[model samples]
Target: MLATTPKPPYYAVIFTSIRTSYDKEYIETAKKMEHLASLQEGYLGHESAREEVGITVSYWKDLESIKHWKSQSDHLLAQQKGRDKWYAAFKTRICLVERDYGFEREEQT
Candidate 1:
């Protein structure tokens, strides 16, 4: 599902990764991180997908919120695990969303 984010001026953290192997814990940790992020002060929403590569884009109120999320304790441990065991490679990019638009068709009953 696509995330419904607030208007422009929001920040997005785009995390792209290639996994090492199917670690049973990866899914659980990912869920945990998403839940934790939702509870944070400036979190807006997120969307994610995984095929040959994994991508997660989380929206926030500002860069400060992104920074806080990065330094969060559990997230810190998860980051270490991703680096040491889960991810073969990963890249993160932060961008200010100046504008966005999309369309969703209504489902037929």
Candidate 2:
């Protein structure tokens, strides 16, 4: 499902990665990070997908929130694990969302 974000002028942290391999530890850590992120201040929402390459875009209210999330203790551990074992390579981009629009089909009963 797509993330339901607030009005524009927010921020998006786009994390794109190439995985070295998948493991139980990696899956668990990913889920933990997602949960931890949701509990943070200024966290709007996030959408993620993984195939040959993985992409996770998390929305934030401001850049400070993004910085806090990055320095979070557990998240710091996860980052090290990713570098040591999980990710072959990764790129993270932070963008200011100036404007946004989308459409979702209504479900019929």
Candidate 3:
């Protein structure tokens, strides 16, 4: 189960993707990136999953943090690889959440 983040004004960036049939070291790189992201300053919380495709949602304290993460050198390479190889298509959406709360079946969205 995914854990709830603290009360906010927070940035929620959602990444949803469909993977290509080609395979490489994606799982390894993904784990490494997750580790790196968790250690990043302003990283609040994250949730992710994979099946026929994948979805990852990462929370940040502010836009600056999100920008820093986006521009990180290693992550930039990964983004390029994603565009070139692993992902056939993807979509990202950023949302601002204020005073959020939730529970199963009846999430306080």
* Top candidate when judged by TM-score against the true structure: 2
**Model 3 agreement with the true structure over 1-109: per-residue lDDT tens digits:** 6846777899999999999986797888889888888888889889999997699999998999999999998889888988999999999898887877666786686
Query: lDDT tens digits, residues 16-84, model 1?
Result: 999997596998999999999999989999999999999999999999999999999999999999999
Q: Compose the digit string of candidate 2's lDDT tens values, residues 1-109.
A: 9999999999999999999965749888999999999999999999999999999999999999999999999999999999999998999999999999999999999
Candidate 3 yields a Cα-based lDDT of 0.88
Q: State each model's CA lDDT, in order.
A: 0.94, 0.96, 0.88
Stretches of model 3 off by over 4 angstroms after superposition: 104-109
Q: What is the lDDT of candidate 1?
A: 0.94
* Top model number, lDDT: 2
Q: What CA RMSD would you report for each candidate?
A: 1.0, 0.9, 4.3
Each candidate structure's count of clashing pairs:
0, 0, 0
Between 1 and 2, whose lDDT is larger?
A: 2
- Candidate 2 runs further than 4 Å off: 22-24
Q: Rank the candidates by lDDT, best first.
A: 2, 1, 3
Cα misplacement distance, residue 37 of candidate 3 (Å)? 0.5
Candidate 1 worst ten-residue window by lDDT:
21-30
